[model samples]
Target: MIKQIPVLDCCTLSGYKEDELLVDHLADYLHKHSSLAFPHRHNFYHMVLFTSGGGAHAIDFTRFEVRPMHMYFMVPGQVHTWEFEGEVNGYVINFSREFFQSLLLRPDFLNGFSFLNGIAQDGAFQVPAHMEEEMTAFFERIYEQVNRVKPLQKDLVSVMLLYVFMRMEQQLSPAEKHKFPVYNYTLLRNFQKLIEQHFTNLRLPKDYADLLYITPNHLNALCKEYLGMQAGEVIRNRILLEAKRLLVSQDMTISEISDELSFNDNSYFTKFFKKLVGMTPEEFRKNKA
Candidate 1:
């Protein structure tokens, strides 16, 4: 019997290979069926630079059209799918949250960065021929140092990677910077972090409220004020989004999905799903498939 590969998080990517930094060029050969391969969110973050071809990429409910010279970032817990046509070339850099935290102390740096904002306002940055040569040189340097046996050299290469990210941030448009609000951003950020961690096991508004050290009402208000949706709505949307992803991509039965989401019972799960989705789980899956 063929064994199945276990699902891995971003942190676990380092352990899979002997050269930790080689995880930087990590690219997966995804076939058509590859979309069904891994449905869970990753713990580590990703910076994907697409060099060629076109496809549909989805994160949460947001989707993007993939083409050459397109760069995208996927933070932990954002469920994503990439469907590619023909050959694609690019580098996928995987680094932990700690890697970024150590470099960007200011919360506004990444919080303000959004692919949507960039595409909407500044237009997707097309790497000029000269710039591509420079980027290739930087990547080659990192690759060589990562493969080096010396520990000091490896650390230096890591620093270079940090420099690359900082440069990329600088290239972002001013509109993108203004999009992210510094104050109260931490609350939203922490709430998202918590949701990614416990969405499967804990779905209640009070659970998140308690974790954030605020009342359920306050949490709801904050989510509403900033996101234009209540806390409960965010929680339910995430759960339902995951449900749809699994239903379309996995062979798991409805009962299995219910158990995975920690629903009280299969019937309750069905009704809850129907109420929000306007159809039974089976019907939804059938329509999608």
Candidate 2:
């Protein structure tokens, strides 16, 4: 167990590849980058469509079985590790955050797909049987263009990728698409951003509410409406998540981890972890180990 999780970036993983992008058959990709079998996080957005596999992989702390035609989308800074039983093959597309930004008018175009969101469970999905042939063909086309770059190769790739995302979106039920109003959804995302940035130092939802220029009650209402949790709960959940991520590595002691998260003390942090997780930090680490 290393003291810190490895955060991988595009260039380091891309190697001889250019253009801030990596496209390859998963089996071939893994053969060359076998070190990735260990737990790690990536700086670039990552996705994989497993055509055949067994066993399971954990994204963050939640485990999902490797399945045929299943797609996993990962955002930057999320820890992922895989345990495989036998052969596992698929198409893995890893690209820098800017891979699509410069090509599209909307800077946050990728976020429109819920599967691209940082949540562990939301990032994993199984494509329908009918769509597998078309999706695999799309992946193949992107792979083919890698070696035979045309004048506007990347532009073509971006269009194909966006179409793939749109097809995925089309599968969602109407109810899932319109759960939160546009304004409230934007506000909720803003609130989440603030929490992500300040969760270590700011413990209260009002602190985030102030940053968002919204009242605490209003912020709470948006969170409750969109996330099914109170604003405070959302903030606490972020802090707890960071704590769990930190605990995964062995470098930090309980006291050090508590201090790192701005906790009042080791005992308080232990109680908080137990109250929600049903196990002490040490116990959780041991069990996972």
Best by lDDT: 2
Residue-level lDDT tens digits of model 2 in 78-104: 988888778999999888998887688
lDDT of all predictions, in order shown?
Answer: 0.64, 0.82
The local lDDT score (0 to 100) that residue 188 gets in candidate 1 is: 70
What lDDT does candidate 1 reach at residue 159? 73
RMSD score of candidate 2 (Å): 2.9
Off by over 4 Å in 2: 1-3, 104-109, 148-152, 172-175
- For model 2, the run of ten residues with the poorest summed lDDT: 172-181
TM-score of each: 0.65, 0.87
lDDT (C-alpha) at residue 112 in model 1:
50
Residue 264 accuracy (lDDT) in model 1: 86
Clashing pairs in 1: none
